[model samples]
Target: MGVRVLGPRDLSAARAVIARDPVVNVFVDSLVQTSGLDPRRGAEVWGYVEKGVLEALCHAGGNMVPVGAGEAALRAFAAYALRRGRNCFQILGPARAVEVLWEALEPHWGPAREVRDDQPFMVIDGPPVITPDPLVRAVEPVELPILYPACVAMYTEEVGVPPQTGPDGTFYRSRVAELIRTGRAFARIEDGKVVFKAEIGSVGTGVCQIQGVWVDPERRGEGLAAPGMAAVVELARQLTPVVTLYVNAFNTPARAAYERVGFRTVETFATILF
Candidate 1:
């Protein structure tokens, strides 16, 4: 098997490998197009091939590097990362794959820090039922000013870490705003108050990613999450055939909420923060 940096010439083969991997949710087609448009800010995606048939792949974006594959493929990908000056790497795959890769690399990289425990990723194949209760309404563009604060509050209360303000906030806000402005975000408001929200990202031919899901603590247990998430799923279905989202493994409440909306656990991914 040979590992190589993927370019425009290798895009077709690289996409095939990603499509074969059930756990890959980044929508390789959209990534390739976006990367091609702006080569400098694009993430580096590597493909592993044997006899010219792609078998595995990995993605490195900024400080986050997600490596997914078997032992041999992972080792080869790791070497490629090392050669490219990547010090920190995050492996997002099954628990067994993560265990194997971490064990193999520990000796050379000191100790691998378990930044976060395994996270459960939920995938929705069909339309989600809009549950009755808590009154959900689609948010308007004018409500973003209010929605942003509520989202930050919800994230802080549930995740224990407040959303970063200033440039960090700007980064996230701008990204979400861009998605919303482009009709990719949906909000669930209760009595004119933004209680929950979800957004779609990285759309491809057959897949779309659902991200930035949040619910206000005050509105918890009222059964608003299912319909709130369903709104995003409904929106995604309009653009793609499938929808997927990732959640922190330890967050049981979020998992339960998503399950109620017809999302099933498809895989586990680790989020390595440096």
Candidate 2:
């Protein structure tokens, strides 16, 4: 068995592996499609080859994502990632694969800042459960200024880091603006403040993976999440056939809200944050 950095020549084979489970592969596929398997494109794909065949892949760079990789491949990828000295903000994907990869990297990386070991990978293949909240809508460019703080708050609370650090929020603002331009940023606003928000973090094949879901602390119990999510789902389906999101298993309330919205756990996912 051999593990090596994949190149453009390996794109088709790598894509096939990603295609085997597109939802789980959405983040990697986004890089492949846009960046053409080039490491210089801010991401790279590594493959484990067995007798001249690519058996598994690791998409590592800013995001260290693995797909369809078992023990051997994961070990090699972890070694390679550690050697390259790139910042892997997160390692996420199929539960078993991610766990295996994390185990292999544990000695080198030590404890992670956070480990979400049992994130339910959920899907809404059918219509979302309507929650009768008429306030949810896509955030407009005009509202970016008003809603940017909420996005920052969600990022800080979820990732344990302020997204807009170092006297520069331009990049963060542009990212939010881009999402709004793509019509992917969904939010509920009241009196010029965002109360609930979510975004289609990645899209691939027929699915859009939802992320950055946040509800204002004061608005947590107002029956806002289900309906706000329903609105997000409604708009997302206009672009893709299926909607998916992963939540920390210990988050019973979020899990319950998703279940109420007709989502079923299609698989379990793991996330390791550095």
Candidate 3:
């Protein structure tokens, strides 16, 4: 088997490999489109080909962000990425592969901080039991003031970064609005106030990724996440056979809520932010 940088000629095979793994595939497609990063540039999607058959795939781009793949293929891909002088790397994949890659690369990049711990990439199958919540519903166009604050609060509190403001805020809002425009955003409103929100990202090959799940602090103990999440899952299921989302390993409450909504842990991934 041999490994090499993906070129335009490799798109067909690359697409096929991506299609086989929908969660990572959707994320890759979204990154290519939303981040304005050209997959044809420093970006490379490497495949392990044996006897004219592609058996494994790995992707590296933009500071060497690495997504999951087979161990042998990833090791080969990392060799190529390091040759380009990319020291910083992020690995989102199975726990074993991550541990192996991190150990192998320690000689080059030193110790890697666990920016995101070994959290599960969960998938929701079957109809979700969305409990009735007076505060949960679809967000409307006229409720930006109510909705924006709730979103900002959740983003800052849960994500540990202040909500983007000014130009950055504009970009963030536009990105969210694009998702809403594409029928991806869902919310729960009570007394005309938005309290919780969730959205699914791009859908391809029967897999949709859930993103930006949030709830008002005051509404946390009220059991609002499951239903709000359920609504999003139900909506995404229209386009795909399964819905997937990632949660921080340390956030037990969020993990419990997701499990209540029929999501099961499938794989553990590490997000290394430098």
Candidate 4:
């Protein structure tokens, strides 16, 4: 078996590999649908071929994500990634695959900043079970000023660091604005403050990945998250048939909220953040 950079010519075959698990591969599949292995899109996919079949791929860029990778494929991808140097901030994918790949890369790229090994990959493919929160609605573009701080707070609280270190938060702000513009950002705002918020971060292959789910610390026990997520599921299904998200296993409340909204664990993922 050999691993090599995939190109536009390999689009169909590469997509076949991603299609093996649409839910787990939605992030990379979205990139393939939009960019088709074009490096200009900020990433390139590396394919692993065995017995003349394209069996696995790694999305190489800011986030290195492996799809359909087995034990052998993981080893080959690790060698390729090692040769390419550590340019990614994280290595994330199916739990066992990421575990094996990191086993190969850690010696060379030791001392990772963090390793999140127990993330439940959950999905909801049908209408939400709970009544959707009528008050939870898509954020309007003009409301970015209100939503922006909540986003930063969510990022800092979840990731253990603020999204931006400097006073200027242009990049993170622009991303939030884009989500709002696309009607993918949802929030429950009261008194000009975001009480709960989430965004559809990645969409492809009839699946959409939800990210940045947040409930205001002050409003934690007020029963906001589940209905807010139910509202998000109703809105998200307008764009894709399936809604998926992953949560740190330690985040019991968030996990319970998602489950209450009709999501179920389908897989496990691991993240090695550097």
Candidate 5:
């Protein structure tokens, strides 16, 4: 009947809702798995209740993501988010749910920096069809210098803004380093330069999400993506059963590469970026 911020006591209920579509909800699920619905850990999960049943949920933090949200739930989440005054840089979810949430927030949070309405949510559970790139391997802490610039370039190109603005990229730098430390960062570094790179951005018990996929601009069109991705997928599946990612629909070349690696469009995602 209404939405409320969830906590550790609500973890089981919240996770039940997330498990409704594990792949599509992997990002939020991973957050819950890692943080256990504890807001102090950095983010909050908002749960919508209908007659005492936790029916839908939204992960509220740097990225506001909804899981299994229908129109009614989306509206409730929007009101809650509007009251919180838009702390997140983006609102993303299933295409229709994101549309509904954006429609509700547009009155107050109007004029988003960008609205990506057609992002294909792709997934690959089995081994990749293409040959794995032998050069692609887990990045080491010592290789952070080579990998950092590539991560920045990729973020700027894909998201239209650098991950950090100030001269010090410490926050973003630490994130990349953490991924490397945990063996989640992968890249093909040749001659002290990163040719291709990606990270296992989120990891749930049964699924993992890939993000920040970037190929060196000068090295594009050389058929490196598919094989590089194959290597990443080959490695990622070791931690989880499924690997998933979402790409802007307009990026045909990237889409083609993903398809060549055997990723299929399982759902459509939309993002309203602030």
Candidate 6:
């Protein structure tokens, strides 16, 4: 039993592993599909192979996501990350997988800066139960200036860090722009201000993971999140077979809004932010 680095030559094998759970695996699937398993792009995949058969895989670098896991494989992947001085932004996946991997990682890596231990991994298999908000629509290129502030506010509020941690906010701005370019960004604009917003954070492996959902602070009690989310899910389904997202269990209002929009808790996810 050994874990080895995977590269472009292992693309088919990687695809097969990711396909096992398209929703939970889309972030890694997108990386491998677009970056081709290359370390050059600051991301690489490692496979837990035994007897020449790949049993599990771990994605390292930007996000330390593990898929197709087993105890042995998860432990090995964690050890590898420890050895490489892993500084990935988060470790997210099925609760069991992330838990086992973290068990191996935490002893050596020390305390996590932040953790959402009870994130509800939700999915929508069909059209939503709520009516889609007609105001919510795909954000256009011209609206980036109007939408960028809302995106920044949402990211900062949800993640507990200023997205402009870079020299001039260029890194965060470019990332939001890239999502908009892909037509994955959506928002409800009213009077030239974004009132509600969401984005497809990952797109691959027949799924899209929605993230960065937000409603303006003043509009919080206006009953916008449910219908707004319904619209977002409808738009997201046009690009993938399904939509998935993980929300902190403590966020009761968000949870209720999502349930009203037809998303069910399919699994549990844990996220450790470094």
lDDT of each: 0.66, 0.84, 0.67, 0.92, 0.92, 0.88
Cα lDDT for residue 143, candidate 1: 74
Candidate 5 least-lDDT 10 residues: 161-170
Candidate 4: where are CA atoms >4 Å away?
A: 164-168
Q: How well is each residue in 48-152 modelled by candidate 3, as lDDT tens digits? A: 676786766655653343443677766776676567655343565556666666666767875655356577889877888655344445566566666676667
Please provide TM-scores, in order, for all candidate models, with all chains considered together: 0.80, 0.94, 0.79, 0.96, 0.97, 0.96
Runs in model 5 lying further than 4 Å from the true structure: 165-168
Better of 2 and 6 by TM-score: 6
TM-score between candidate 6 and the true structure:
0.96
How far is 116's C-alpha from truth in model 5 (Å)? 0.6
Candidate 1 Cα misplacement greater than 4 A, ranges: 27-29, 63-68, 87-91, 104-114, 130-139, 151-169, 190-193
Candidate 2, position 2, lDDT: 74
Candidate 2 lDDT tens digits, 1-274: 7778888888899899989888777777777887788777757678989989898888777678888887877878878877776577788888898888888788888689889889998999877876636788888889988778998999998888888444664888888888999888989898998999999888888888899999999889988888888888888898888889999999898999888888899898888888
- Candidate 6 on 1-274: residue-level lDDT in tens? 7888998888888889888877778778878888888788757789999888888889887688898888988988887787788768888888888888888888877588887789999999799888999999998988889989998899889989877457775888888888899899999999999999999998896788999999999999899999999999999999887899999999999999999999999888889887
Residue 230 deviation, candidate 5, in Å?
0.8
What CA RMSD would you report for each candidate?
3.5, 1.7, 3.8, 1.5, 1.2, 1.4
Candidate 1 lDDT for residue 190: 59
lDDT tens string, model 4, 182-239? 9999999999999999999999889999999999999999889999999999999999
Model 5: per-residue Cα lDDT over 9-121, one tens digit each: 99899889988899899999888998888888869889999999999999999899988888899999999988888888888889999999988899899899999999999
**Residue 15 lDDT (model 4):** 89
Per-residue lDDT value at 154 in model 5: 94
Q: In TM-score terms, which candidate is top?
A: 5
Model 2 regions more than 4 Å off: 164-167
Clashing pairs in 6: none
Q: How many Å off is the CA of 142 in candidate 4?
A: 1.1
